[model samples]
Target chain A: MPLPAKAFQRWLHGIAPDTSMADVCRLSQVKRTTLAQQLVRGKVAEATVVSISRAFNVSPVTSLAYFEVYRDLAGPLVPPTRQELVSQIATVDLLRAVIARTAPEEGGGGAEESTARPAESWELSPVPHATSVKNWVDAIDDGELRHRVSAATGIAPQNYSAQLTANRLAPEVAIATSRAAGVGLAGGLVATGLITEAEAGWAAGARRAALDGLSDGELTALAGDRLQTLGKALRRQEHDQEQTEKIWENLG
Target chain B: MIEILQWTTLVACAAATLSRIPNLVRKKNRSLFYIFALMTVATLLSIKAPYLAIDGMLGNTNVANLLLRFIIFGAIYFLGMRIAKGFGDVHGLQFIRGRAGTVVLGLISLALLILFALMDSEGSSVGMMDVYAKDERNRLLVEYYGAAGRAYPAYVCLAILPAMLRAAGSTLPAMLRISALLLAVGGIAITLSLLFPVIPPALGYLTFIINYTAILCFVFGLMLIWLAKAMARRKVPEHIRKPAGT
Candidate 1:
């Protein structure tokens, strides 16, 4: 049997059995009537949810996610707009680009590859194959692909297929799918005109030389471990650059 | 000893003038260049030989005295405005931005010039060395000239002192901070000289010493500020470092 739609309410009741709804309102600093209406509708504001979570001594993100799951179970959520969907996909594409740029070569022989070929020969291919988001998603045939993508992206498995079908996959979902399927979805998105040329250019430029010797499977496997390291390094570089500029401005 | 001190001051003024030439050639910070140029001319006039030479050229009517008084006072006023503007640029203070403050200063300078001219007479000499030895009536006029002349430059210096101190305390580079400190010291020195009431027999020599020391400090401070900026531009950011073992 499927789990009850009121899982969040049930959890709330279990944790705060003796605490009245008025007590929750008082603790959260939300109005009694508003809390009651939100509880009934299975929808809570993030601030109110965080406050309630604090009152119950629960993790705020976990509590918020529970509420989101409960709200979806209670009613079908409205789909995101097309523009939002595209933006989400672009963000995923950007993440993937970062991954591809930092990923090591397939044979672990990056130095060797450079030595074997002239530096200019490693420039990105001018006419790489183009594929759309729909075409890329359709190519994957595994029954558990939705689950894998959901696990990676944190989107519900049930919604993955629908989102993929409607071209509404969030960036995280796209990144997860890219990891699972062993392909760069961002490149495909760029090719299909979903991601603009300007948006994709930086990623392409950064990764082109690094990725020259790597095959499809190697890039996908590399994405899982390199994400945090590259993200941190990029942020550190940006911070250092900012500090240098500030020092120069002060000297002036 | 006083003549040697005067010559040292003249040398310092000449050095300041030479230092500003590169800045002028680069077309950078023209206001600062003009300040140095004015200071040089003022310093030249303050020396006995140049003052007497110019006095002789003007048929000993003391017009050079009037002209030198105006130039020195005007230079100090302009220096104050420039410092105020520099402080404004660094700290975003609105009161120091425009020409209105400088115009007000100019008017005050003009008034001082007129006062000095009205005090000048057949017996009343203008330069510090000759002014003290005149008759009782002439001495009163010379005292007026002396007080006004010292007080105006002192006022300009004291007015800009707080801003220089603030700049010294701010996040400006070490050289600029040092520059500001030097300027503040110069301002304080000039102000102290003005505040002293007793006219020592060595008053002329003392004034020349104080004025030159202040100008040298200010000039050195400005040079450090420029040097700091140049060094900062030449520094490379750490992120642009080459790959390890490259």
Candidate 2:
């Protein structure tokens, strides 16, 4: 995925063929010896590429996109993935969820809280839930879809769980999940926020309407599942932050 | 060749110490400044010309060599304490500054003084061990002194190695991680240097090479951390200023 030494040379020639390496180093602020060593090794370092981008009047991201691994970053308007959406939920919203779960009930056996409200603006968007990718995958799954998707994608169960926690699925894994669930092939892409529901050919308001149409029990179960995972993640994060704080206090 | 390496190492240690003078004068991180200063003096005293010159001023008895050993102990102690506290390594800190650490350091210092006193008082010489090796009884006393001088540093280095390795793998700044790695290498080199006397005479060429290389690594490692701090205080230079992007 890295731009090879030859390709980097080609790029340099394309930009300013007449310039000497010394001049390039002067402009880019890269060390001449380091650049020469990298060239000798048939690779160009990322820092060298970044410095070259500045010298050549190109954005670092645009220059970085020349590498295959960074091609996804070159797109003008790539949407945030489902994991990003889940991670971006407001603190107040998270607190509300926690409070709702533990609040005293006026009457015994009351209906779930989610069924009491209509779909809100954030929920009715083309990309629907603020919940993690894991919860969405679990909700759409029939009994064996997760296992089948994992087998097809060649991602181990633990790795799959980790990806879900991060709210991400590889594009192929997303497609495999949809295939295993017997849904539209692009459903996984839409669920992962790789593509909008509109791009996936969903009718206006259909995605929101589908979410609104789920039964109270199903909604409650999904909410419970998402909150449980989120609580564990939050606690682990808090513990780690405490340790980092101690290190900083002693050293920094 | 050994003399050349020793002088080269002294120059480098001097440079590293000199580079930190601004910080030292401002009373910032005085412990680090002291570490570099002590190490510089130790390096100076280890070299032949400076050792002979200074020993002549101090009553012509090679006590400068003993002073060099004590300075080395001070340098290693400060370096170990800094690494242990910076990494929040409780075990390393306890082993270094705790009761057991004090006892070990005291014992080593006592042993070094006793061995030096027992050796026949002689005219000044830079390489005391090499000079005393001509006489069997003085050779034994010098050998014991050398072992005593190395014992505390080896102990401190052993205690700090785990902390250094952990810091190398941690999410600290890149320069700090690299410094930790260099310190670990220096510690291992020092340990190997201690064992060099046990190796066959044919492999003796490695003695000064390993010793000097360990000194250079330690100096460069500390210098890197100092440079990183200095750079962090400065604004990005205009020449490499990143172009605004979409």
Superposition error at B53 for model 1 (Å): 1.1
Worst 10 residues of 1 chain A by lDDT: A72-81
Each candidate structure's TM-score, on Cα atoms with residue i matched to residue i, is: 0.45, 0.61
The worst-scoring run of ten residues by lDDT in candidate 2 chain A lies at: A83-92
- Model 2, B94-205: lDDT tens digits are 9999999999999999999998898874677865855476699988888778878888888988898898888787546677778779988998888776786587879877
lDDT of 1 by residue, B124-152 (tens): 23374455465665567666666666766
Instruction: Name the 10 consecutive residues with the lowest summed lDDT in model 2 chain B.
Output: B237-246
Question: Model 1: runs farther than 4 Å from truth?
Answer: A1-252, B89-107, B120-128, B202-205, B237-246
Model 2 pairs whose backbones collide: A83-A167
iRMSD values, candidates in order = 10.4, 9.6
RMSD after CA superposition, every candidate: 20.3, 10.3
lDDT of 2 at A27: 97
Q: What is the DockQ of each candidate?
A: 0.02, 0.08
